[model samples]
Target: MLTSAPPDDASPPVDAGRSRDAADARFEALARMARGHFGVSTALITQLDAGRQSILAGAGGSCGATLAELASCGQTIADAGMVVVADTRADQRLRDHPLVIDNPCLRFYARCPLLASSGGTLGAFCLFDDKPGELDDEQREFLRDLARLAAMAVESDSTAARLQEEADALRANEGRMALAIAGSGTGIWDRNLQTQEIHYSSGWKSILGYADDQVSNRIEDSYRRIHPDDLAYVQASMQAHFERKTPSYEVEHRIRCQDGSYKWISSRGKVVSRDSEGQPLRMIGTTTDISAMHAMSERLQQSVDLITCLTDEVPGLVFQYRRLPHGEAFFSYASAGIWDIYEVSPQQVASSAAAIDAIIHPDDREAYRASLDTSAASLTPWDLEYRVQLPRQGLRWRQGAARPRRLEDGSTLWHGFITDVTDRKRIEAELQEFATTDFLTQLPNRRHFMKHIEAELARIQRNDGGCAAVLMCDMDHFKAINDQWGHALGDLALRHVATILREQLRKTDMAGRVGGEEFAVVLSDADIPAAMAFARRVQQRLAATPLAEGDQRIALTISIGIAVMTASDASVDAALSRSDRALYRAKESGRNRIECL
Candidate 1:
């Protein structure tokens, strides 16, 4: 269906070696699907070359935006951001692109690069249209997310192909089941349990593809028609129902149809009359043509078999999440992968769906609930990334994606996968921290400290009666320590001082290494008196602690400055300046004391 060749003899297989493209039918279908969703004239998986670009899939339409004009793809690759130009003509860079100047000129463009796990950009998925276009934030996010999926498809082609094969097999089995159910026949039967007599309607004979005259009215005829293997089980079940152990008599068994082949029959009946002795005198039921039902059941068994196989082979938790109309959530099925991430087995989660939900980090639960509500309302796929708290492992990153279905009864079901993305998230966090954390003290660097200060300032603005304070700390005669001992001991001294700060500060208070041998703390909701007291505690603690090397101990001391945020203090910088001036006073008044302003 996605042949990249020309029609008839002129067509040739796509040149895969010359360009990087999915070159697969599935990928082509996905490209077209994206095109449909975007309502764009052209959508392509393209290999964006330095000077030229080649369409790998979809319509193979060329975009008018060239490198000299506005190489959106080039910019996307360089910045690693999804690029979108709502109106190319309005932008000077793109206004000169060929598409904007030519007939049937393209006016809108958007693209997300297909980045490989190796961190290399591998072409891109792009959309272009003749008319000006725009996309909302959610739509852009979806586009970028879809590009990630596309990258996976391209990278893991073999896995996708194997899944397709299994899907095809399942679909074929479904077709056969449907045919069997459609060609079924029904019959009627009644029996007098007390008299040991049986009666069969003409329809009952016709159900077996036989005339009424060919069948006997005796109960033996029914017994002889049942398959030997199914007779015992059918008889036991019906006996239980007749003895009042079950609510009704219903059983399925194979019976000989007229064409010499066995067909499945589901016989059902209930006792309409009872004797005075509290015993059933007679019972009647209808026999359904259930040959198709048996076939369908077998197909279902095969489906479960495949599901079990795939679930075990997959890398993440597979689950069927259901929410009933009455607001009850049930986890119908869960894979063994649940043990790896949640520290709980599949059976445990299945036993109670809330067990998994409850383990989500408390701070993340509200957003998770809101996402679920929105997805259920719009029947949209739920793609969420959040943190989960494991009893022993602390908090970890988890990404869940579910395809939702709404039932007639107002219940919702989601077939989804939840993967443990903790490793990736941790690496990302480390990379980000490396940029904003001081390597020596392992505290926030100057830039990161400013961000926290701004956030706390915003909190104060939002509060009706709020207060905050800043503490500036500097090591006294730190230069002499490095000169007397060595830089290694000086580093040790910094680490020791960092430890002291962490030990003395509350979790709500933030400490940062803003300069060499200089540190600062931002205390939320702290008054001037509290700030001054905290500074004195740190000054005393620093005076008591000493850094020891093999045979000698170096006395350690610090100068502290405190400044509380005031009504006239316009910014964090203003309060920080006041604290710095106070710190100067502490240093001037004989180095090892506290000063407040």
Candidate 2:
């Protein structure tokens, strides 16, 4: 809480000697009126802060309490500025009000706003009862009127001090102007035509980190703060300012602060007063911290240096391209690894975009175009890998990505980087091929097969004119071949059987290696009879194919089973189960036969 010294009672009374006397008399009358009307132990009139409506004065000890203690009463009474009675013993909202629950002395209370001369609520006048009671509306109105009169007297006392305050403010402005012109611990000089002597402020000595009393109040003494490199130019500027009536002077140079550290400060000043002969007389100005600005300038130069170094600094190709309306166009972007990736200089590729586009793999150009088209239409980011031809070398894979932003003219500009990703792309393709195809037969593996099954199931579900049939085929007598001609011969026989089956199936049918000796086929648009016929053809083809090894021709046979899939099947697992059951029955019936389930 901020506390101001209480006004002296003996200095001047409001009525007898000054306006305060009248204010006291007015407040005394208000207290009498409130006490008579409220019939309470004490009736007090108080003032409130203008910026804040919290009670600043009261009848007795209540005025001494900080605003935080009053809580809800402070907000309610201060804002509404009307008669409010919190009879805690009877009113539920205030039954547990802080004043009643915490300090039993305030069981009932009534307060009416004290109106300032401007008609703003300044504070209140009220009576507190130790027991619950209420004040009627008429009595409340009477107390409010009396409080208004008391507030008016307070305003009258404030009016008396207005002139003295204006005088004090004018004196403060003069001091500020003098100090500013003198400069804060900064040396300033003026020539007096009458004496031909220079005048400087105490700051002149302090600018050099010297005590004002220790240093002679001379212009040269203050010049000690200027860096030796800038002292000559600064001296010359001052000479020109005085000789030509330059009106103003400014310089950003190093200065010695109080702690003896060299800090950069810009001191600026303008002539505030001059003699009748057009000669400069007085000046005023300020010094500002420019260390941040200097640091930023230094960082900007460093960034330029870094960019200059990057032209030949890195290893991999670092090229940039901008997307244009016709297609993605290459500007004069740079790369350090242009020679390494494409056996060409960055200058050559930057100048000729058609030459760069010619390097894209013939098969991958359409894919690259589609990606660019999608990105341009949506204004979305794009990343793609495409093969580029290298001079006298094989193809190299390059990964290019661009971030596009829409311009005000409804055109898109893309900022993109191209990097050599041949090694990474090669590795990724190997991994993907390994994941999707069987190693031994080079056919679609289980993971890829399940993807096809799901697509076919979805198509059937959508009434897209296709029922899919899954044919599970197991090599017959494969263990016997391994037992007779060794595992190598048996492996050759399996490969031969897989090749024969693939050739026998239609182009629409997908064949996959599902297990050690088991294979699966997804036949599109093939119902139960069609699938059975296809399975029989695969069985007969496998039975006829002969696996050729070192010196032997091994004959192979396949037991085939087909399952026509329906939408009611919960998952691929259900379809595979049905196929497996059919395969089991096919094997039980006899080897080299086709069965449907």
Candidate 3:
């Protein structure tokens, strides 16, 4: 039945001499074409090994080199397609190669990679010469087309050999196969299905630590060693085979070893021939030790079960990630719970991880990609908390953590979890806002404003070269305006001042409503002159803008007091205190006037 169906791990048949001759003949035609078209001295088709290449065919001549000695094909192979180097000495990647530095002193080189169907680089078709040259777009494209044809030829040869191999393997003699199996540390058995008895080879008895004569050839003798829990399944398998339900008798079970412990084994067999009644007349099989495989499978099962339970009960997603060497990525596994968080199915993300990228908030996508690149570069764990936007859900914050590893083939894989942290983030933001930001103005309140000032001072002190200035502004006659217009318009007027502060100030500057009708600015790295200039600008802008309600327009003005963070001012409070006194002086001199201290 293995011949009736394709096997999972069958390799193609091989004939060293004849296959080599056929390969060389086929490639010689191609080598000739390449040499004629490119006018190169050497044209060869090669097979790449880990640290070397074997020249299969050539025009002009062919030779081999250790990869360390000259890996002239390396660049083309890595690129996985055509590469043209105009001058070998000008190419840094190939400049120091022995072939370039010494003999022939080859100057021109162009090669196209022979790609395998499985996406691995096999080797290259190369053209080399002493004269420097370059290819135009049409010539480069022509080389790629030739490489594709070469790949098709390789695949055709392999497929024919594989078919022949399967036919031969199907007819391999049972006695010879059994003898071979025994030599390879496997056990063989022959069974009479009608008699319900089996003859086991000496190797089978040895596997269980039984003396050859101590074990009987009877099937019941084998039954005694099988684990009790496997008895019913074994009986069922035999019955199904008798009914012809399965193609063969293949089962995995634990058998009691001689020391009274179990060892997992895989039994594979087929009915060799059938009687006139269509019953199985004879069956032969081989047993392979699978204790290590069983243990690993059990551990894997535990992990799967754990994730399944969490997918149903937990509020998040879990996944296994695969990233190929060429930057293509997919999710090998994703929990169904992702649908709730991302409004996308596990299958969708599994098929293409780009679907997840599409839903991530646009503002955060660059950061997300950057984090992955950085993590891959450093081989560090990736940890990110970022916002994602959904059409229905609006914006939400998600926390993600993944451990990344580089695989042998140069790809990277990550095992990660993503959880909905929106509620927690919201709570944290509220708490922080209440502590530092003014409820009415939505600007930093007094406490946080002072903290900002403290930080700026620390930065200025460390750098020891930047300037700083502070401005104190109070609504002119704010108490009288509140008395006449009521607290509502008074509140509106305060908001008006806060808006100007936000719209006019640079991002580097910080402004806060430090108290009722009192606003302040901390200009980082601003000198006394810059501070006065800013104060004058605010004076001009506010004088021109006014607040209106129900056809009533009220003109407004603010008096500003400015002070610089000079070398003598050790603390933010000292600058603030000076600005406050300056404001008092400004109020006494004239309302709407700018005063500096």
- Go through the candidates in order and give the clash count of each: 1, 7, 1
Q: State each model's CA lDDT, in order.
A: 0.74, 0.65, 0.75
**Could you give candidate 3's per-residue lDDT for residues 147-233 as a string of tens digits?**
655665555455446544654786766565555444444687889877878887766777767776877767877888889999889
Superposed by TM-score, candidate 3 places the C-alpha of residue 574 at a distance from the truth, in angstroms, of 3.8
lDDT digits (tens) for residues 1-597 of candidate 2: 111211342111111112222346546655654553455545655565533333323332233332234322423332445545556556554555555566665666676666664667665666666666775676655566566555655554453354346446767474454464344233444534344444545555455465656644455555886778888887777667767757567778887766778877677766666688867666555555455446535644665567647845666555555555655466456666667766777777664566666777899988987987788799788899888777777788888788665643555656566777878888988999999988888888988988998888888878845578988999888888899999887777767777877786787778998888889998988899988877777666655656776686777888877898877776777888888899999999987888888
| Every candidate's CA RMSD | 18.5, 20.8, 19.1
How does model 2 fare in lDDT?
0.65
Pairs clashing in candidate 1?
6-11
The number of the candidate with the highest lDDT is 3
* TM agreement with the true structure for every prediction: 0.48, 0.46, 0.48
Q: Which residue pairs in model 2 clash with each other?
A: 13-21, 14-20, 14-21, 14-22, 15-21, 15-22, 185-203
Stretches > 4 Å off in candidate 3: 1-310, 323-328, 349-354, 357-381, 389-395, 403-413, 454-468, 481-486, 500-508, 523-557
Candidate 1 has its poorest 10 consecutive residues by lDDT at 68-77
Error of 1 at 463 (Å): 6.5
The most accurate candidate by TM-score is 1
